[model samples]
Target: MSYKSHTVLLIPGIFDRGSSLLRMQRALAEEGFDAHYIHLRYNSGWHGMEHLSSQLMAKIEKLVKKETTCTLVGFSMGGIVARYYLQAMSGINRVHKFISIASPHYGSYWAHFLPYKGGKQLRVGSEFLRGLNQSVRVLEATEPVSIWTKYDVTIMPHSSAKLEIGTSYEVPVILHRLMPMSSKVISLLKKEVITGMG
Candidate 1:
């Protein structure tokens, strides 16, 4: 069977070893899309979002063909990693669609407990996020989409998942970490990736 031209790169969230995204990958495969996910080298993001983003860039460079664009589906902090690549690493030009699921685009209160460069950057008013928020318009080149749940405890004020530059969908999923594996979220992804709907 012929697969879709654009690849769907699944970037797992913090603490995700890889299995978190298997269901999504399987769904995409069954739908005839090219899907791939690698366990991030800096899964904890201790080094910083840029470091994690660089790793994503390298994988993209190796996996995607020059003729093909990619669709990025980042879960939680994985979303921030993808944004760093898009806004700072010039990844917007290479993407056809950008999707962030349960990501803290506005920073998370829960980040206060995690004392690390990556966690600090995820705080409510970090310079890293400030810089990215200012230029979120860049993602407009690709059809940017945000998926979040109202019950997300990890984001502490789940509205943080609503981005300033994209269409936001509120799924009824209960937990933040389970978003990528939720059938509702997966179905939403399929719709967004295929239709780019508003």
Candidate 2:
């Protein structure tokens, strides 16, 4: 059977290994979308978001060479990584759709508890956040979708996951890490990607 022209890449949250996104990848495959996950060089929170974003960009570059279109499904910190590549690194041209699940687009209060460049960047009002916010318009070139849970405990003030330029959804899933595994989130993500293709 001929596959869809687009491929979906899954970026996992901070400290999460690439394998953590297996459930998401499987869901996308079942929906007839080619899905893959990147093995981030650094899974720790010690590096800056830019560092992680660079790795993600490399994967996107390689994938786009084979597929006509690409979609990014970032989980938690993975969303931030994709944003950096899209907003700061001029990745909008490479991506057709962006889906953020439980990400901290507006910065999270708990980020201050960690002592690392990446962690600090997640704190509210960080320079990284300032730059990301300023380039929010870049996302307009591609479809953006923000999926978050109201009961997330990790991203305090979970509303930080919402984006100004995209459609937002709130799920009843209580745990932050379980978002990708939630069928509701996966279904929404598939709908967005397919709709964007149309």
Query: Can you write out model 2's per-residue Cα lDDT over 8-98, one digit (the tens) per residue?
Result: 8899998888766887788779878888987786866587888988988888778766436588888998999999999888787778888
The stretch of ten residues in a row with the least summed lDDT in candidate 1 is: 1-10
Give the runs in model 2 whose Cα sits over 4 Å from its true position: 1-4
Residue pairs of candidate 1 with colliding backbone atoms: none
Best lDDT goes to which candidate?
Answer: 1
Q: Model 1, range 134-180, lDDT digits (tens) per residue?
A: 99899997778999999999996788998877688999988887899
TM of each candidate vs. truth = 0.94, 0.94
**What TM-score quantifies how close candidate 1 is to the native fold?**
0.94
Give the Cα error of residue 194 in candidate 2, in Å: 1.1
Q: Each candidate's lDDT (Cα)?
A: 0.87, 0.85
